[model samples]
Target: MKKKHMARGTGALVLVTGLAISAIGNPAHAALSGQALVNSKCATCHEAKTDQHWTRIGESRRTPEGWDMTVARMTFAHGVKLSSEERGAVVKYLADTYGLAPDETADHRYIIERTPSVVEHPESKPIGDTCARCHSYGRIAVQRRTEDDWRKLVHFHVGQFPAIEIQAGGRDRNWFEIATGDVAKELGKVYGYDTASWKQWQAQKHADASGVWRLVGNRPGVGAYEGKATIARTGDDRYSVAMVMRYENGSEESAKGSAIVYTGHEWRATLKQGGRDIHQVFSLGANGAELNGRWFEANNDAVGGTMRAVRADKGVPASVLSVQPAMVRAGMRTTLAINGVGLNGEVNLGRGVKVIKLVEQSAERIVAEVEVAKDVASSSRDVQVGRASGAGLLKLYKQIDYVKVLPQHPMARVGGNGGSQPKVPAQLEAIAWAAGPDGKPGTADDIRLGAVPAAWSVDNLNKMAAEMQDTKFAGRIEQTGLFVPNGAGPNAERKYKTNNAGELKVTATVKDGSRMVKASAPLIVTVQRFNDPPIR
Candidate 1:
């Protein structure tokens, strides 16, 4: 050096001295001076100086625009605080020194030695030299990926900064080879290529989905109720599950149900009700013959439930063998004038996958589920009325004697041994459907709800609330459902043998203090139909 001048606190002097000492011990240390600069700055977020990263930078040969985006990402996304000018300079340096070349400079070995590694060789940012500047090495190495994948990722890092200025006497490809090629080769052989090691290393993050269930349905105030379902798999053919349907007030109502499948034919279920423990049993007939044995919970329960799944119609579970049914191969950008008041949305392909999701909701409208595939997607919306409207409708039905059974109403069936027919409980039951694409309600079909109509308004809600002023958020109500004693009147008997495709309409006007609102909606009911008993 031409009379080396001492600059205090520069750290340059100390760094140079340290390097000299390190070189004395191991000459290879001398080739990494430029990497040392990157280590002091760029490595704050990236990995170390390694051949893998250097090679990536060499191949990009990016223009100034590329470097601008890269630096902006660092400042915006990663919280790097470099000034705009500084970022520009760094990009210039990289582009000049390592930009792609027509010669063999684009080769991997040429760039690797030019790059640096994370301080401790993290699996994610292994070739970043400034790794120690921010995070501990242990936090990074948990990810598992292949060597080639790692190489490609390293390239992304270098391309992000294209304006790095060229430095005289800067060693390039040869330097890169020693750091990345040799070291990574050794590490890969030692670590193997799989997630097993990463899992073992990060065993703390493992999770199990025991006792998780999702429940869904459509009832006035009953959007959906999800809770733990007592579950037990009965040998190979039977699966038993029990869940409590909770009301708005948070009181529990037990719904004990189980499905029994015999041979490879169909599945059958019997549902019983109870306060704490179930007592009676009522068989629910199946729509699909094979349904007697196959019950797919279908993310329908809240995060906890035991649903013993049985193969209803199986030839090796077709859903698993094929690609997702919703994937689109090709289609025109055709628009369908979506009908139904509460239903409007668009489905499109994103990147390479199709994503279908709700984009908006209209007044009183709720989408039960949405799906778009290739050229087909279903959208829906519906309205929800307030408690006042619901009470008003029920009262109207009662006034008109439209309600066939009285004991089911809490007001009519207060005392013990109250009514002849099975009482309708105060709690919202699973939505019973009347008609769908196939036309039969409760006959078993997927019930889809379009958007809520404007009919379900704050004014309507207020009006409905006013009607229930006496009830006043009473929380939980005690009522029974359609329970008929043995020797009851004709209408009083629980008619399990008959499937009645009944319908329910409700209009409510609710009051929020002085302001009033109104809402109305429709409901469907499916009752098992009973025909003339055989004249045996």
Candidate 2:
């Protein structure tokens, strides 16, 4: 008996796509001779023996036209060497065994599925793998195109990837015609290409804001002094800034930076500067300021300098020579939120501040300046008791009171000081935090004032949480007060209410998973009720 030439099916033919097959003849007894005959001559070039040799197309049974196309593909694309007689014989054998039945849907599907995959087709890779890396491959394949349009993408890729080799030389314009026409032919056969639909797709994907640069801050304002910036997705990953800085005397100087920013939800830019090609990373925070990184000398030692990104759109004017802000107190942290293209040069806060610690928030950094708030405290004598006289603001700055960040939910007070009389309450409404000399808010030295309304802002909460990074709600001020006033004066009496006050017993409960942490503070809301004169 002739050795069974039961050649296994080629894997290239059988993709993950499960194609249905109709049984033609009994393979157990049919033609072992046909396999041997083809192998002796065709195997030398066809390379397909068992499953391994089957071209991606061969797995499907196709019509005569399809078979003819495959033969062309193998011979022309693969350089398959076959004599005319041998090729005729192989075609005859394949047709007799696997010819499509006229009405079978399987035959049609097989024909369709036999179209080349991206790897098998050279043109598909540029659109499929390269373009698809950042976006969808459908984005490119669906575009309606002229030969020129197709060539543009080809040229673009060749330019960007550099490793990509296009058939066209720098000046050879005709190469587009050849490449696009070939691609169009293949696509027409495979997807039944519709030019109109393709053009619509291209228009949608290709048309975007080009050449325009955007400067987006986390939120609004120009720099860190006003309020901390709130970063978003776009500015987190990419930051583009264009600015023409006008000097104190009104002379313009240009500053531009196009950077790839890793926002990580905060704003920080890794920038490449001109001339020296130096790379620097700048971190920004809320308000009207910024902090810059060290300058690396071209392949040499780096010297660090403070960079205060002054929001030129607002703030008081200063000398043009100073790019950094005036530091008021040694340790005062500041942040900036920049949103426009033009900024004033004098907005940098450079008077008497020293950066003590820096905290990163998304793309910006919170530059903490070190200054003692005690040195800057206005009152040296016996402090009066009231809600004004700058005493309330000072208490809030000193973090002597605890404020409820979530104003909607007031802390439930129990047994401490519960009375309708004008007296100090057992609990306060908000929490206050210490302020550095530069006037930047710091974390609370300790939880003191219980539950006050003034400490409900996100900024205050973040400061109260400090480096621990534990706070998640946004709040608004409901009330403001100072149990200890700055000074006593006739004008301050009405403004600072030193008379009837109500006391509160405040209880705070913070839950961490299954564990609960609780604390309490005494609060007083002063009210002027009596006009009785005091007799000495």
lDDT of candidate 2 over 256-312, digit per residue (tens): 444332111112222233333333333332221433232222221111122334333
RMSD of 2: 30.6
Which candidate number maximizes TM-score? 1
Candidate 1 residue runs with Cα over 4 Å from true position: 1-215, 218-221, 227-236, 242-258, 262-266, 270-419, 422-506, 510-536
Model 2: residues with Cα > 4 Å off, grouped in runs: 1-236, 243-253, 263-274, 283-301, 308-536
Compute each candidate's TM-score over C-alphas. 0.22, 0.17
Candidate 2, overall lDDT? 0.29
CA lDDT, every prediction? 0.27, 0.29
lDDT (C-alpha) at residue 28 in model 2: 25
Worst 10 residues of 1 by lDDT: 392-401
TM-score of 1: 0.22
